[model samples]
Target: MKIAIFDISNYHYTYLYSQCKIFENDRVDFYVSKFLKKSMEKEGVLNNSNFNWIVLNDFDNKYKYYKKVIKTLNNKKYDYVFFNTLQENWLLNFYFFITVNKNIKINLTLHNINIFIKCSRKLKIKRLLRTIIRRIAFYRANSYNVYGENLKIYLEKYLMKKNINKPITGIPFSIYENIKCLNDMNNKIKIIIPGTFDLKRRNYYDIYNLLKNIKNFKFELILLGRVKKDFEEEILLEKFKKFKEVILFEEYVSEEVFDEYMRKADILLAPIIKQIEMDGVLEEYGITKETGVSFAAIRYSLPVILPKEIKVMKEIEKIALVYENFEDLIRIVTKLFDDKALIQKYTEKAKKISYTYTPLKQREKLFNELKLGR
Candidate 1:
């Protein structure tokens, strides 16, 4: 099969390319977006990346970009095309109106649905048009692949509301198989807070407060993320500097350094903030992301400590130590610190379950769901 996964940026690199490496007999290609090229240099992933990627034409305007992208993709004559990241803006639903290859089956994976589903419908007419755009984007696409289980359910309702009938499959984000199981009970338990560290989303303050209360534990707290060149964010980095326990990597970490930290750490701390709220559902539903940190922890046979309320917890229940808030997280951390057996138990559980979420497994699942694996 001639398959190509487009929008191959640094962020969505793991989900698509990780599985592509394991494909048995297939002609797989990657289409790097023009937007991703700029982000690569800005984010610092292009400096010393081992990631095998080909850059596309770096166009200044959307019209030129779409024209070139459509022509380049159409000429490939691919049987199947998977989009790693697709949303309204950054790269609009122009692909639907533009792609000339009508026979080519297109698949898309959405990171979030905040754009599609509005929090408030204050402007009634504007909401109607936004809804129409969402319908067209999903309805026109051949397959809709969601990351986590809870998100899949949410999208299902949205799809039904829009009267768009399509195949929606829930695929877990895959981890690379090369990550070795490295766990040391005697060493200080490392609790990590990774991804884009910011007040709006990650909320570094929340994690700091949690650490302040837990005084007894002998652990190193690490905050790793892209702390950009912003002045306010730099001041926030200064705050973390005061704590001896906290280690901050405020930029794009090289692959070598990242792998070293992953192996060194015992636990991953994902203090993701809840933003958008549904009418019936709790606000915590906003933080159910299948993060790269958690995926690495699972792959490396390390335990994860996440909020019990986050929707992604349900999927990682066997491997994770799910807690309510600081009160719950503090207790779990203290217990894991003291009880080596408990730590080992959860680590082993994560290793056992890690097999289920490998990129190869997800690729096979996708093929089976689409009746192409057999």
Candidate 2:
């Protein structure tokens, strides 16, 4: 079972880093890219020396990078290669697959199926070409997995239309299982916002307004994760300086401090925007984009509040709260503040559910499925 999770050097801290640790065993290796960015080069970037991490060199184009990746790992003779590259390279993956290491099996995780769908629906020659490339790469893959139900559904239809019958499983992004679930019994309801404050992706404004309006409940709000460059708009939304109940860790937080926040917080607030019209990124209508933190809330035995109508909430709603608007979110929080027993119920449920997807269980399942072949 010589397995490898590849190309996580760009920005793996969100979900890729945890996947590396989850699938890691003596037989597995993390093929990290040497694409040094501020996210991984900074102080909070995870120290990946614990596992067999092989640094991969990057190239100007996808084909060159694929060639180099295959050449670099030729000596290892890996049995399975998990291609975790972003969907921006969807058009090039077919060529990469056909050209490099054809003998080896590949398990691809599509991160942006929605974006490709959006692009294909448009009536333009460029999009038509992109749609063709998208289908070819998608169907030609050895095996495929997805991060959200929405994307999984889209893949099914996309593959069906192309007359390719491939099994596409919705794989929950992995979280480190070692961290103890901290069931904090705080007097004030502490709600923490996790992940980057990307203008198009998250709703920091709603969180800010929620804090300002909710004077009846004794609570604190903490903003965690690396703030994007244009995050000043959110800062302007609510003068963070005046809010005594808010704490901001506006950078990539270390794993230690993040666990501490999880321990102290009573509930996690995930105000994910439904869609983002951007290139090279998926328009995520779900928490599956933030699967790491959402599951972290579960792993830490804390219930979470997510945006309503999110595709992932279909499963998450059983263990956490969902709200449609600010008022709805406020009412939900109010209920949690008044009902400690309910919080305990959700916490227990979260722990129970999170346990179902433990690292050993998940990796073994993935290995077995990939072994079955498409």
At residue 343, give the lDDT of candidate 1: 78
What is the lDDT for 138 in model 1?
54
For residues 1-374, what per-residue lDDT tens digits would candidate 2 score against the true structure? 56666764466554564465454453666666665223344523345444465564555555566566667666568776777764345545555555555666666776666544445334477556556666555555677877645556667787788787766754566543645655455667778887766767777778767777776777777877766767475565357657888787656777668767877777788887777654443465652243545566645656788877665544455776889888999899878888888888887777767776676766666556555432
The 0-to-1 C-alpha lDDT of every candidate, in the order given, reads 0.63, 0.64
TM-score of each prediction: 0.79, 0.80
Over 4 Å off in model 2, which ranges? Answer: 34-52, 57-66, 72-77, 87-95, 116-136, 148-150, 176-178, 231-238, 280-282, 287-292, 371-374
Clashing pairs in 2: none
Residue 324 in candidate 1, Cα distance off native in Å: 2.3
Error of 2 at 7 (Å): 0.7
Q: How far is candidate 2 from the true structure (C-alpha RMSD, Å)?
A: 4.5
Cα distance off (Å), candidate 2, residue 329: 1.8
Any runs in candidate 1 off by more than 4 Å, and if so which? 8-10, 22-24, 33-54, 59-69, 72-77, 87-99, 117-135, 161-163, 228-236, 276-289
